[model samples]
Target: MDGATGFAVSALVNILLSLAGIALSWWVLQNVRLDLFLREPKGIQAKVLYILLSIIFGHGLASFLNDYMSWSQMLGSLFG
Candidate 1:
């Protein structure tokens, strides 16, 4: 494949991998509910917390997988 094609494939794969992380994070959040015991406006803070948790969980899991499996290099190779 050409360099541009390789980079495009690598970028697409990376995006999908992160999305898998988000999906997994969503599944876990659905299974585990967190109650902050706050009223309406204050409750928005709780929602924010949930959003942050999902982002953290998603990125954290993705980063861990790449590091553990040494797939980061493979992905880098695609770009190179």
Candidate 2:
């Protein structure tokens, strides 16, 4: 692929990975008992907090995965 095409593909992959990460984070967070830590677990603020937490954790997870994938791909250069 040309540079432009490669870049586009990479961008798409990153977006998909980020979305998947966010979804996975949200799903996993659903099992947590927020009521133990929040005074108004059922309130709108709590819902907003949940969304923020999911994004934060999801971004972190996605970043880690992206870096790992990049590093693994770079490994091939060592033997080439």
Q: Which candidate number would show the highest lDDT if scored against the true structure?
A: 2
For model 2 the local lDDT of residue 5 reads 100
Off by over 4 Å in 1: 36-42, 67-80
RMSD per model, one decimal: 5.0, 0.7
**Per-prediction TM-score to the true structure, in the order listed:** 0.65, 0.96
Each candidate's lDDT (Cα)? Answer: 0.75, 0.92
What TM-score would candidate 2 get against the native?
0.96
Model 1: per-residue lDDT, tens digit, 1-80? 99999889867866777789977887787656476344653477877866777888998888787576567677888999
Candidate 1 residue pairs in backbone clash: none
What TM value does model 1 have?
Answer: 0.65
Q: Best candidate, TM-score-wise?
A: 2
- Structure candidate 2, residue pairs in collision: none
List model 2 lDDT by residue over 1-80, tens digit each.
99999999989989998999999999989999987999999999999988998999999999999999899889988888
